[model samples]
Target: MKKVIIVGAVGGGATAASQLRYYDKEMEITVYDRDTTMSYAACGTPYVIGGVIEEESSIIMATPEQFQDKRNIDVLLEHEIIEIRRSQKQVLVRNLATGKEFTDSYDALILSPGGSAIMPEIDGMDGHVFSLRSYADMQAIQSFIAREKPSHCVVSGAGFIGLEMAENLSHLGLEVAIVHKSASILSILDEDLSKILQKELLSHGIDVYTDAVIDKINGNTLHLSNGKKLESDLVIMSIGLKPNTSLAEQAGLSIGVTGGIQTNDFMQTDDPFIYAIGDATENDDFITGDPKRVPLAVPAHRQAFIAARHITGNPIAKKGLLGTSILKVFDLDAAMTGLTETQIKEKGLLAKTVVHIGNSNAGYYPDHSKLTLKVHYNPETRQLLGAQCIGGKGVDKRIDVLATAIYGGLTIDDLQALELCYAPPFSSPKDPVNMIGYKAIE
Candidate 1:
């Protein structure tokens, strides 16, 4: 019987443990998490905060007891793995609740400590400020909102989390101001597309400040570098995430340029008997083949399968990542898959991009709506590289098709050739996706 131990039982770790148990029923498995709530969807935290999801417990997919009973996998909640002894093949773990320490030996180990919220040092920033990373963080933010009933919120950082927090806080009827040091937000979208999204945000009364800086925070007052001050009742930092790789670094594992654990297509680290997954590991870019960190839940869950299959002796290679993602803001929807024009330019890759606008449904239909679609392709080979879509409806479905097309090694010609179903209520005769493809060919 093989003994396996997994750390950080959230998206990646929990999924890996479940996969291993499914493949080898007799395998001895133990999963440890520093937090009590394990196997819950972290991505759904924003909706819960916004009252879009009413029940907090509904997000939890499985409990420790449930996993232990059904999967026969031992789950230790509120247990922290402090150290890994590579030579001894054992981990020194401390019970977070009791401060008691113990050792667990393993024939194989999976590392998935995930990422940490990067909170920069600003004057007077303390417990009063917040960043949502875990279930606890979400609960704290909710508690603060309920207790104080704050009317004004200053959310620093205009990235994914920042935007989501901004929208959710605004949905709660609070005036939200989004601040970013950059000239524009959403680095995933081109400047023109991002400008349109910015206007949509302005229509919702959400304040956006680009090319901005936070000078200091004194009590409830936030002073800006441009000599502006806001009476802020709440502050949320959504700057970015740093990969949790200190354990791997201490264990002498190799790190990548992206500051994540370096692993092969099999997810095997430099140490053959060990593996890493989730936000803690860097991924190979599908289009540019660059070392990239895609801190999304879907890729983490997929990596679990790849690691588990290889551990069970299948030795399957994983497909490189496209960093496919989507988000909702008020009445609008935005999604992106594959490389962006900005990234392609940075990599010195020649890409032909086409931006097209079309109605999602037949123009004459009552429910028809316009969507902006951008597709990127190799100028020479005409291979499909990436795509972005912004619209009220059908954005999600369109992004998924483009992601699949990229994965299938499809080209611009292939995209135009894709035979898609159409109805007066749902799609136009020339679907928005096909429109982009046809534009790419031109």
Candidate 2:
């Protein structure tokens, strides 16, 4: 039986451990995480902070007891893997609680330590600031909020976590403002689309500022580069994240252009016996075939299964990701798949895009909501390259369908002819997807 050792028991590591046990019950599987908790939903941290989720414990997917009792997997909680000695096929493990260190050997190793939130150094940036990357961060912020009763909270970025923090802070009845260093909010979206999102955020009474960066934070005041200062009681930094690759790099694993552990279609790293998955691994883009770091839960879980299958002789290869993602702020929902127009142009690809405004369902439907759909296509062949959507109720569905289309290499003609279910309560005979396709044909 092969001895498998896994590091960092988040979505990727946890799924790999479970799948490994399923593939080979006789294999000795040991999972190690520095956190005291077991497999939990890190993505749900924002909801817990916003008060939408009443209990922090509910976000945890499984406990250490569940892993051992149910899966027969040994989970070492509060144990950290400080070093990986690939030549010896062993790892140096340290017990965070006991301050004791040990070494363990493995036939195969999987790296999935994930990424940490970026906190830029600004004056007065100490315990008063927060970053919602882990469950502990969530707990810490909740405790501080309860104890301090901050009246105004300033969120220092406007990406997914940044905006989510802004919304959740408002839910807690605290005045929130989002300060984005970039010219537009949601830099992931096109500039024009970002304009629309800014309007929506403002409509909800959240202060949205762009091209604005904090110079320093001084006791209840945020000094800005524009020589302006805003008073706030707390600051949540959501700038960005860099892949945690120290363990992999130290072990002589090859890193990619994107700063993530490089892996092939089989999710195998440079060393055949080693594999890396999840937020820590650089993945291939389905459209561009370039390495990109997509740090999301579903991709991490899927990659984990792929890595396990390959190691166990099942060998199910992983296709590239389209980087499909979604976000919700207050009542509005936005989803995107494949490349953005900015990316397309930057790549020097000859492409054009069209944006359409329509309703989620039929116009006559009572609960219908407006939707903005933008699609990128190869101008010469009208091939569907990418799509972005913003709306309520039906945003995820549309983006999901487009994601499939891009994966299948469907062209404009193909999308227009695609069959889809339709009802007044759900969609029109010509769904928004078909409309974009039909427009592309025009």
Candidate 3:
């Protein structure tokens, strides 16, 4: 029987192991993870910290016992793969609990090491600083919150994770303040839309500081580059994430400019026997065709499918990522897919943008909240380059439709012809998507 060894047992790795089993029932599959917990929903960590998710165990999707009994796969938690010997098709595994090392040989190997949260270098950051990248990190933050009962929190960075953490922390009745280095929060959206979100954050009693950086953390007080001092009982850093590619680099795999393992369309590394997936691997962008790292769960899951299929004698080329993402800020939903208008201008692409302000449904409908839709397209080719939507409702649906359109290679004009569901309670006769397409023509 063919033996397979997978490193990491989270989103991509666990999914790949199950997929591999589905394709080849008789294959020997063993997954190793350094963490005691495996296959937990990392995205919901913030909710748990905020007490929204009452129990941390609720986020865990699968356990080792479950994988072994149901899937007939060996899942060794707290076993870390220290080194990969490509010549012998073996890996040096260390029992983290016992400090013993062993060698395991594999016919095929998959790496899904994921990423690490970036902790910026700031003076006096040794006290009450936290980052949410792992289950342990979430538990630590919750423990601190429960024990200390911190009254105020200073969240550094204003991206998706940052905003989510802020909202959750605020939900716990803690005074929340967000300080972002960029000109606007949620850089995925343009400044105008981001400004609206900034207002939302402010309206919810969350202080918003733009173009500011944390220079030092002295005790529970944070000093900013803008000459402002914030009294934070604890600080959460959601600045960014760096791909965990040290193992791949040590194995002599080709690393891309994005600092992720470079893989072919088959998700195979430079060594055909070794496959890489998840945030640790960089793939081509959907529109630009340039290498990009998408550290989102959906992309990781999709890559897991592609990698497993290729290993099981079925090959499928990976369609590039659109970087589609969405996040909820207090009461508003912000979503975007494909390239942004700023990115198009930076690429010197000839693009035109259409902005439409309309209602989630018909204006006559009760509680019809306002929605803003912005789309970017090539004037000559009419190809939809990107889209952004922010509203109280229907933002997710429209973004999914646009993302699907971009995936299907649909042009801006095609959106006008889209037969979207229309009702007074759901959408208007000319949906916001259709209205944007119609406005693009004018």
Best by lDDT: 3
Score every model by TM-score: 0.98, 0.98, 0.99
TM-score, model 2 to reference: 0.98
- At residue 273, candidate 2 shows an lDDT of 82
In Å, residue 131's CA in model 2 sits off its true spot by: 0.6
Better of 2 and 3 by TM-score: 3
- lDDT per residue as tens, model 1, 28-78: 999999997999999999889999899999999999999989999999999
Clashing pairs in 1: none
Q: Which candidate number maximizes TM-score?
A: 3
Model 3 regions lying over 4 Å from their true place: none
The residue-level lDDT of candidate 2 at 159 comes to 91
lDDT, residue 240, model 3: 93
Worst 10 residues of 1 by lDDT: 433-442
